[model samples]
Target: MKKVHLGLDVGGTASRWVACDPDGQVVARGSVDGATAHVFNPAERQRLGTALAQMAAALVAEDLVAVGMVGGLTGFGSAAAAEIAALAKEALGLAPAQLLLTDDIVLAFAAQFQPGEGHLISAGTGSIGVHVAADGKMTRVGGRGILIDDAGSGSWIALRALDAIYRVLDRTGSLAEVQRLAGALFALVGGSEWHHVRQYVYGGDRGRIGALAVGVAQAAEAGDATALQILAEAGAELARLAQALQTRAGDRPIALIGGVLNLHGSIGTEIQNRLPGTPISQPNSDTALAAARLQASGEEHAWRAILASMLTPPVPSLGSSVSAAAP
Candidate 1:
C-alpha cells in the first residue's frame, strides 16, 4: 500500500488539506467547508467532524491511505484539545499517535519562519499577530475573534463599511444618494432593505460577514472614499498588531498572511506606510502542504525547507485600483 501523510489547515473561512508521499511530493489536495476549532460548541464540533469526514471521503476516493495526520485548527484551545483530537481520529481513522493538532495561526507562522526568527500577522476572517520564541513559548496580539477585536480582519472591515452605510441611511432616509459602496453592499446583501441587510449580517456566520470585504474592496477600487478609508484603517490596525508584538518579537521582520491582505493593495500599502522601515514580506507557501510535511518528517526545518522549495515566484504588486464593477 502506498503510504501518505495528511495535513489540514482549518479556519473560519475555509479548510484546506493536502496529502503527501514520503518524499514530500503532493499526491492529493482539496478543500472542504470551513470549520472552527471550538469543539465545546456542539454546532462547531459537528461542523468540524463533518468537514473531516468529507476530507476522509475524498482521500478514500483517491485510494489514499493516511499513515499520519497534522491539523491546525482555528480557535483551538487546550480545554478542547482532547475532544478535537477524538473527532479527528474518529473521522480520519487515525490512531492517537498518528495525529497532531495545533492552532491554525501557529502552523502559518511555522510555514514562514522558524521559532524566534520573525513575527507573523495573519488577517483572514479574523486578525492576529504571533511570535514563537526559541524556547517554544508563544506571544500573541489581537487574535480575539470577531466578537471582540480582530481589528484588521475581514469581518472588521465589513463591519466598518456596514456601520458607515447605515449611518448614511439614517440621515438621508434613502440609499439613493449613497455612492458605490452602498450599491456594492446592497447587491451583496441581495437588497437595500433593512431586513435584507439585517438578515445577511445576523443570520450568517463570521465567514459570511467577512466575505462582504470583497464587495468593500471592489468599491474602494472604484474610488469610493468610504471604502478606501476603511481599508486604510484596516491596514493601520494590522500594523498595530505587528507593533504590539514588537515588545517581545524585538526587531523581527513581519510576515503578512491571510486573505484580508490580498483583498486590496491599499491595505498592504497602508501597513508599509504606518510601519516604515520594518521588513515586511508576504510568503505564499501552502500551509496545508507544510503541515503535511511536518507530519511526515516530525522536524520543523525539514518541512520548512520542503515548502520553501515549492514557493512560486512573487507576482507583481497590485495597483491602487482593483478591477471590478461596483455592485
Candidate 2:
C-alpha cells in the first residue's frame, strides 16, 4: 500500500478533506460541521480535533502519503495558515509524516494559476485580493474584513441589506427585498426584534451576518434591486483590490474566486469590466497544493529568493473559466 496525501479545507462553516493518490488524483474525502468559527473555547477545540481525527482516520490507508490543511485558521492571527497547518498535522496524528497545508485563500490562488501572473479577487463571506508575482513572492493586497476595511464583502452587503431595512422602517424608502432576508436571519438566530440585534451589535457574534450573506445573494439573484446594488458595490470593491494589485504588480493575470465574485450577471460582470484584464482561468489542482509546494520548497528562509524563482519558469495559468468551489 502506498501512502496518500490528504488536503483539508476548513471554511467558515465546514471542514473538508481531499485524499490524493500518488499520481495527485483526489481519491477519498470527508468533512464535518463545526469547522468554521471565529473564536473557539476548549470545547470548540476538542470538537475540531475530533472532527479532524475522524476524517483522517476514515480516509487514511497504508497507501496514504501525507496530510495537509487548507483552512482552519481560527484565532491564529497573522500566522493563521502556518499555525493551523502545524496544529492540523498534530491533530491528525500525521506529525511525523509529510504534511502540506496552508490557508484556504492560498489554495484558491493556486487552484487558478500557480506561480502565474496576475491578481486574484476572492469575495465570499469575506473579501481579499492576493497578488502572486511571476517572481514567486506572494503579497496580500486586500482582505480586511468589515470590522476593519472590507468595503465590498458578504458582511458589508448583509449590513447594507439590514440598513436598507432600517431605512424602510424609518419611512425613508422600501427595500422590499431585504424584508424577506432580514426577517429570515432574525428568525434563525431567535431574535424577532431590532433590540435583539442592537443588544448584540458589538458582542462579536459573526454567525448572524455571515449566514445572512447567503440570503442577501439569493434575493439579489431573484431580482432585488437593493440586493443587486449591494452586490454591485461589493463587486466594485473587490475589483478595486485587484486593480490595486495590478497597478502595483505590473499587470499580472487576475483570477476571481469566492462565491461573491462569481455571482451571475450584473455584479460579477460589472466587476470584471471595472478591473480590465484578460481573466486567467482556474487549474485542476487546489491552490493548497500550490502553497504546499511552496512550503515544501522551504522558502521561509528567503521568501524573496523563492519569489524570484517563480518569475523564471512554470508560469501560472488556469485551464478552466469558472468553478463553484466556495471559499
Candidate 3:
C-alpha cells in the first residue's frame, strides 16, 4: 500500500489542499474559502476555522495508517498552531507527530528556493518577508498583523487610497491632483456617495478591503499621481522588507509573490528594481503546491527539486494595464 501525505495552504482569500503518495503523485486535491485565526471579526474567524476543519475532515482518508500532514496556514502563529493542530488531528484522526503547522510564508519561501539561501516578500491581504538561511534557520519580518503593521501590503495601499478619497471629500488637500485621484477612487469604490464608501470601508473584511488596491493599481496605470505614489511607496516598503531580511539572511534571490506583483505593473517592476539582484520574478509555485511538496518529502531541502517535476516551468519574465475597474 502506498503511503499518503497531506499538504495544506490555508489563506485569507482561499484555502487549498493536496493528498499525494510517496512518489509525489497527487491523488486528491480540494479547495475552499480562506481560513484565518487572526481577523478583526470573531465570526469571520470562526467561519474560517469551520472551513478548515471541514476541508480537513473531508480530505482525510480513514483507512490510511498514520498519515503525515504539513499545513502552511496564514495567520497561524505559535499561539494558534497547537489549537489548529488539534483541530486537524481531531477531524482527521491523526496523531501529534503526524501533523505539522508552520507559517505560510515559510512554505512560500521553501517553494521558491532550494536548500540554499533566499528571501521572500509576499503580499496579499497582508504582507511578510521570510529569509531561509543556507543552514535552514528561518528569519521573519513584518508579519505583525494588519492593524498596526503590514506596510506595503494590499490593505496598506487601499487605506492610503481611502485616505486620499476622504481628503478630497473634506477639501483637506488643495492639490488638484489629489482631488482628481480621490474622485477616481470614489468611483472605484462604488460612486454612490461618501456614506456608501464609508460603509463599504468599515463593513468590509480585510480581503475585501485589500482587493481595492487593484483599483489603485489601475489608477496608477492611468497616470494618477496619487495612485502612482502609493504603488511606489508600497514597492519601497516591500524592498525595505527584503533589505531587512538580507541584513540577517544574506543576499540571495528574492521571490516576490502576491496579487499586487501578479498584476505585473509598475508596482511589480518597482519591487524588482528595489531588490538587489537580477531577474526578480514570481514564486515558482503557490503556497498550496509548496505545502504539498513539503508533505511529500518531509525534507526541508526538497522543495525545489520535488516541485520542479510537478509544476510547469514559470512563464518567461514579462510585465499591467490601466482600467477603471480592477481585475
Per-residue lDDT over 26-122 for candidate 2, one digit per residue giving the tens place of the 0 to 100 score: 6666666545333235665665666667765675543454543333232223323343445567656555234443346655665565455556777
The candidate that wins on TM-score is 1
lDDT string, candidate 1, 176-223, tens digits: 544799999888889988899999999998889999999999999899
Task: Give the lDDT of residue 149 in candidate 3.
Answer: 76
lDDT of each: 0.83, 0.57, 0.69
Best by lDDT: 1
Per-model RMSD to reference: 9.6, 8.0, 9.8
Residue lDDT tens for model 3, 1-327: 335787878777788887777777777777877776553457755766687676665664443433777777765555565666666666666775676666577677767776455677888778888765554555678867567778889888989888776676567544465655665566667864768778888888788788888778767767888888888888888888888877876777777888767542677767777764545667556566556656777773344343232222234444432111001
The model with the greater lDDT, 1 or 3, is 1
How well does candidate 3 score on lDDT at residue 258? 80
Q: What is the lDDT of residue 201 in candidate 1?
A: 94
